[model samples]
Target: MNFRRLLAATAASVIATTGLVACSSDSADTKDTAAAAAGETITVGTTDASKKAWAAFEEEAKKAGFDIKVTNFGDYNTPNQALEAGELDTNNFQHLKFLAEYNNGNGTDLVPIVATEIVPLALFWKDHDSIDGIEGEEIAVPNDSVNLGRAINVLSQAGLLTLKEQGLITPTQLDIDEAKSKVKITPIDAAQTPAAYGEGKPAIINNSFLDRAGIDPTTSVFQDDPASEEAEPYINAFVVRAEDADNEQLHKLAQVWHTDAVQKAVAEDSKGTSVSVERTPEELQAILERLEGQLKK
Candidate 1:
């Protein structure tokens, strides 16, 4: 099935299992009580690759009077849809780019409330030690649009491929300016990039996937531009429905996430694989615009 259909099915399943309830105003006593109850049992949806990251967040949430229950999804597509359908209170497995694309394509009005991490994408090889030595070698990348485009852009930025003079937010392989590198590019499922690496081929693996494969981000050879204006929008963050952004429980949860305790936990648990970023909404919007411009070009 196509991605949209799969997402619809997933959302249907979640809504079927969890009765959808109307969201009340912030001043409603019932809403406050419901939020408190929800805090005692907030369901967070994410992928297995992000378990460690969320565990740190969960511990911090508990210290802030929340008892969080995390549920793992096998793929990247389901979490936001589940959240919008009321199956999950929030999710933290996606970057702004993916969230924006999901919102645009699926019409889901989810919004990010907190910045969490910068999981650097790494260009890796099993046999070759550097990007220059990968000539004639097979290189694997994510097949999905968002990740695939990111892999291609990273390769382009590394001088491995020349993309058409187009914006960056959603550049594809078709934009590759070829003649820049000699390596053969192959598209593989994002989840399978790690295994492909073990098979002695070069690959671009997402930071979380690298962790799942027991590969350390600190040791990768060709790292993406983590601080580039092009990468800001792609930094992962926490997302909730737009209507719930001002909910008291969510605000409290956001506060706990920004504390030094959570930041330290994220750094220690991810082993410095993921960097935490807590920005005000104004600052985040500015960063997002800058990133969007860089990506668009």
Candidate 2:
């Protein structure tokens, strides 16, 4: 099946689990009481607990009348594993594509309960200030599966490269339409992309490393559009075990990231790079399902 059809079919199958319910005030009140009575201290796992926005998020959750303990992991692989092992109640660090790959590879059923935001992948060159200046040259990309595909998409969208005419989801080096492309890609470790940029090679750098590299985010020659429909797979979200998909408290806590204070802090933390997006749980789950299908193929 095509991508949209795949998404529709997958979304339809799980609507009951992920969809929003319109309840009367009385029922909503009952749910709140029940949620309070549970008195569970939610433990949320993340890769970046030091971000000021997370502190703001915690405060907002307190205002909403629940407590959450945020735990930080040093690497990308641990958070989901912790969530799957019941060491964490939820996690908010990964996008749907990453979650899909993890689920497919690990045989886990983690699902996104609420969307956070997409941090656009950008191409930066120390010596060049414009995309046109870097034509017919090599651009470095993250070698990892999750970011390599996104880097290719960013280069393609920036008009520096071309991709094969196919239903390419998470494409690789082989998917490049080399004969029609202007630039070549060099896949490297994500952490080293900044060093590659320092050597004057154009590199698509992940947002996480920008600050440490002292690279100005706004200096990127080109970046993928986070608000675009093609970016659905890149939408970061609060993820939980499939069984907790209906946990009202977790869902509410995830939504609290959108409050004014949290949003402001998040933007500042990202150096104005993080674009806050509001997507329904159903939408996030559908994207995750579609991405998983692509991985299975």
Candidate 3:
């Protein structure tokens, strides 16, 4: 897999229609689980397969007697696209908010098998040491709808801005109460947020871009608390087609992410920014349903 090419793909890449797959029977799911347990290769897709955590996860899965094939994708949409097309059994690379946007936009019903972790969106700046007392300056945020809402929430939490609706799941720039806001928001591509910050203005940089840009995660002025209830929508998870939601072996593979080895590697890879979270499959489905419903409205 060309890691650079995948990373180079913008978050705004076009969403192709993910043709629906028919639901399978419970007995079929049981048989599939049995096959996986008997050493059938489970093809899992992810964007960050090059991360250290993946190597650890593969080792752990081997110990648990599951043959895991981790296929790496370059962009956010392709893995879910592959999963929906039955080309991949499962994929772990996006949060519920992102998944909701994908499903609602493309009319696909991919579901989360288990919760994974949350990496908080953060405010970074080159010239400012604090988020306060800086007024009328343009702060760059990711323009991708899912993350733009998150970035706005981060600024709101820091008292840098106010939202017209207090609990918007996917707020936009028009939702901001600009008259009362301390800083002006400039929407830009997420991958370009770091560059915007380097230009001496505050930018809401996603954790995924911090390392490559040589920005330390610890240097963030303010970040959302991943453990909070408000952060639930952003919890990342291992997603499979809705029909495969109950596949036991796949759920077990998702749980392998929380093992000590995987967690340690994740911490090191994310520089302690990735907060491990656990939510039952039912809870994840409930969250996705709620988000999807709200999105449709």
Highest-TM-score candidate? 2
Error of 2 at 206 (Å): 1.0
User: Regarding lDDT, does 1 or 3 come out ahead?
Assistant: 3
TM-score of each: 0.74, 0.86, 0.86
lDDT of 1 by residue, 241-294 (tens): 765554556657766766776677677666776666667655664555455445
Candidate scoring better on TM-score of 1 and 2: 2
Task: Encode model 3's per-residue lDDT on 8-104: one tens digit a residue.
Answer: 1312232224322233364445454455545367889999899999999999989888787999998989998898787788899999988998999
Better of 1 and 3 by TM-score: 3
Candidates ranked by TM-score: 2, 3, 1
Model 1 residue 115 CA deviation in Å? 0.7
Off by over 4 Å in 1: 1-41, 127-138, 180-184, 208-214, 283-297
Error in Å for residue 74 of model 2: 2.3
Cα deviation in Å at residue 77, candidate 1? 3.5
Regions of candidate 2 where Cα sits further than 4 Å from its true position = 1-32
Model 2: which ten-residue window has the lowest total lDDT?
1-10
Candidate 3 regions off by >4 Å? 1-33, 127-129
lDDT of 3 at 246: 56
Q: What is the C-alpha lDDT of each candidate?
A: 0.69, 0.81, 0.81
